[model samples]
Target: MIPAAFDYKAPTTVEEALSAMAEAGDDGKVIAGGQSLLPVMRMRMNAPEVLIDLGKVSSLRGISDEGDSIRIGAMTTYQSVLDDASVKEHLVLLHKVVETIADPQIRHRGTLGGSVAHADPAGDVGAATLALEATMVIAGSGGEREVPASEFFKGLFDTAVDEGELLVALRFPKHTGWGAHYEKFVRVAHQWAIVAVAATVKADGGTISEARVAFTNMGDRPLRATSVEQALAGASATEDAVRQACASAADGTSPPSDLNGDADYRRSIAPVLTRRAVLAAAEA
Candidate 1:
């Protein structure tokens, strides 16, 4: 299979890209790195009339420190994330997850914004962003707008981005006063998660001051395990307490039963994975 014939535009500026997208309307699609989109296009899953390439837009690819957050350009590759000193010092959870995304080759081309925009439920970046409570910056014909991590993802293969909107960057809140870690369970060294968990725990003199738990591949979207977070609110940072809190991870989730594994298996493993993640984060 092959993508249908389409016009191509390499826009050097965000304003130009927005104008091109507005003109192309529903028949337009943006490509940055193209790690995932090209394969789907080759399979005929997406055949847009216009392909707007943002690869040459230098303004859309960089890492900078903002007042209260770290701004990562949409086209920043996963490998670059692994090497970013600011991200390593501030957003340690993301640093841990970037290494687990895929093999080196895939990491070299996969961008943070691309993963979030693609919104694959099983994607590590999506679940990590959810747990990190980040913000997504998007641009369109009208102007720029920020979408919260929780609201950015709508469902499997879907996002809050509207027509003519292109994701410009991701903003991760500072983790200066937090302890964080990311844990993923994959059958092989480089593969999609069987089930994954990301945990952020902030300590306040031996008591669990704050806790956040998020899951990957547990539903149609990357989700925060609110039940577990609520349960762990003020509990002692003990193994018993962590295990008990993890018990609530799959409470409201109708995890899919796909060819990878069954719903029962994912449900069963989610709590265990969450427990391990929380422990690692708490110890950090």
Candidate 2:
């Protein structure tokens, strides 16, 4: 299917891209990587008056190590992230999760910013980022500002990035000694997870000192398993303990009943996967 005819502008700078978007108003769509946007356009799901391409915006694509955190530019591809030494050494949890997103070919084109901005609840990256407490950077006519991951995602296919605003980067604090794991349940290779869990555990003297747990496909947006986190904190790092805490994995979630599985089926498996993830993270 061919998309509707539209004007396109490849901007080399953030300000220029914002200007194009402002001019196009609500009918403009900013695209980078095009891995997500192009497909929607081809299917005629979105017909923008102008497509602002950020392909030439070199400033928006790279990984930089700040003193306390790693700043990942919005246009940074999944493949680039997988190859970064800093990410592998300091943000190992993210490294593990990125390895499971789609296949090699898709990874080379899909951007972390695109995936999060698209706000697909089933997408794996959101859960990992949410668990990591990453910060999102947004740029618009009013200049730039930051939004925490907890408040960034609003609902299914929705986010805090308003009209004429572009997500420019993501900032992840260094995990240092923390151990993390991403557990996904996929029926086939490189398939979307029916239900997934991201766990980061910090152990002290054989006890879980701190724990962060987030869920994918559990609600309208990536959700922090606060009940599980509270239950696991200060608890012994054991399979039984993790299992007990994970029982609340589906407590506040409203998972969808789709072709993948029904809401009840997902609720049933959440604890099983959460246990596996927490156990693996605790041991790491």
What are the runs in model 1 whose C-alpha is more than 4 Å off? none
Top candidate, metric TM-score: 2
TM-scores for all candidates: the values are 0.96, 0.97
lDDT string, candidate 2, 43-100, tens digits: 9999998989888999999999998999999999999999999999888889989999
Best by lDDT: 2
Q: What value does the lDDT take at residue 177 in candidate 2?
A: 88
Worst 10 residues of 1 by lDDT: 174-183
Alpha carbon lDDT of each predicted model:
0.89, 0.92
Off by over 4 Å in 2: none
Candidate 2's TM-score: 0.97
The CA-based lDDT of model 1 is what?
Answer: 0.89
